[model samples]
Target: MKRSGPLLTLVAGLLFALFLLALNATTGTRGASSYGEESPAAPAAPASASPPATRTAPPPSQSPSPSTGPVPDAGYAGRTDDDSASVAVSLRDGRAIAYFCDGRNKESWLKGDVKADGTMKLTGRDGAELTGTLTAGERIRGTVDVGGARHGFTADKAVKPSGLYRATATVRGAKLVGGWIVLPSGRQVGILARDGKPSAAPAIDPSTGVVTVDGRRLTARPVAP
Candidate 1:
């Protein structure tokens, strides 16, 4: 009886040890699986997106325009062959104003339009007319018609001392008109008229604008047309 009892106790101790080992093995496997599930590897980082491209504009261009306007005209003066008739002309912006006279009674104020080609046809009182061409270097060649008489003439450009001058006064109950032209080269020519009749003119001072015609002292003045 004592021997059977010790054998039964020994068997019981062995069975208990085997059960503890099996339980420990199962616990270790479960712990390992839980750790793997809780700490999964971090997902790969997403690639960074690129910035949008920028664009630029261009500049404008520059250019020139053309011109449009009429050409200007110039001045001129001269006398006839016999020194009996004189002429002076002033031109501006294709327009012309002229004076024709013989120191005595015959005189005319003329006006007209000049062409781009320098051609001109001017008319004045008493059916007087002048047709001319303004040549290069400020020269004028023309034909003048007065009272049905035609005369050819050539005149040069008038400058400073060679410009047009005029004088006027009442003498002996008559109106007297006079004109003097002092050439740039110091040459002088003049004409005087009383009541529309041609007569001789007196000596003139170009610088002072003084004149004496028919015993009348008159102050002449420079005229720009």
Candidate 2:
């Protein structure tokens, strides 16, 4: 019986040791799984930084805007398209005066204001009118109307000694009024009116602007608007 009890105790101790080993194996597996779940994965490398984008400039324009401005104060002179008349214009302080003459029997005087856009409108006696615009070439392009006749004219900018002139005198108890247009070529065309009668005028020195009419001396001065 003693031998049987010792054998039974040995069997029980062996079973208990086997149970402890099985329990330790289960706990080790569970701890290993928990540690793997808690660990974090490394962050993926940041996407390589992209280079700054390049920008291109636009091309320049081929055509440019037109020139524009106000009319300058000066004198302009030219002939009619038909070569039948001479026209003279003077501008001052935004005001304008014009004269149209055929140097023989027909003459008209006009006056008006110059616009900021370089346009002009002038009227005279006997249904006479003139309209013109300043152009890029520093010329006045316009049409003149006199005695029911319309004529186109282009007048260029006039420098010194190439402009309008006027003379007034009395000869033989008659009032004599003269107007002259001295051109850039030093040639001049004028008309003399005696008591409202028109006639071709005598030549005058452009430098001195003086003329002798019927033994009387008269000074021809520059005309202004």
- The most accurate candidate by TM-score is 2
Q: How close is candidate 2 to the true structure, as a TM-score?
A: 0.70
User: Which ranges of candidate 1 are over 4 A from the true structure?
Assistant: 1-74, 81-84, 214-216
- Tens-digit lDDT track for model 2 on 190-211? 8999999999989888888889
Residue-level lDDT of model 1, residues 1-225, one tens digit each, is: 999999999999899999999999999999998887897689999999999887766676756432233434556778865666877777877788777777565677778888777789999998989889876547878988876777787778877667677888998899988877666566766777788776657768877888876576799876544
In model 2, the runs with Cα more than 4 Å from the true position are 1-67
Q: Give candidate 2's whole-model lDDT.
A: 0.89
* Clash pairs for candidate 2: none
Indicate which candidate wins on lDDT. Answer: 2
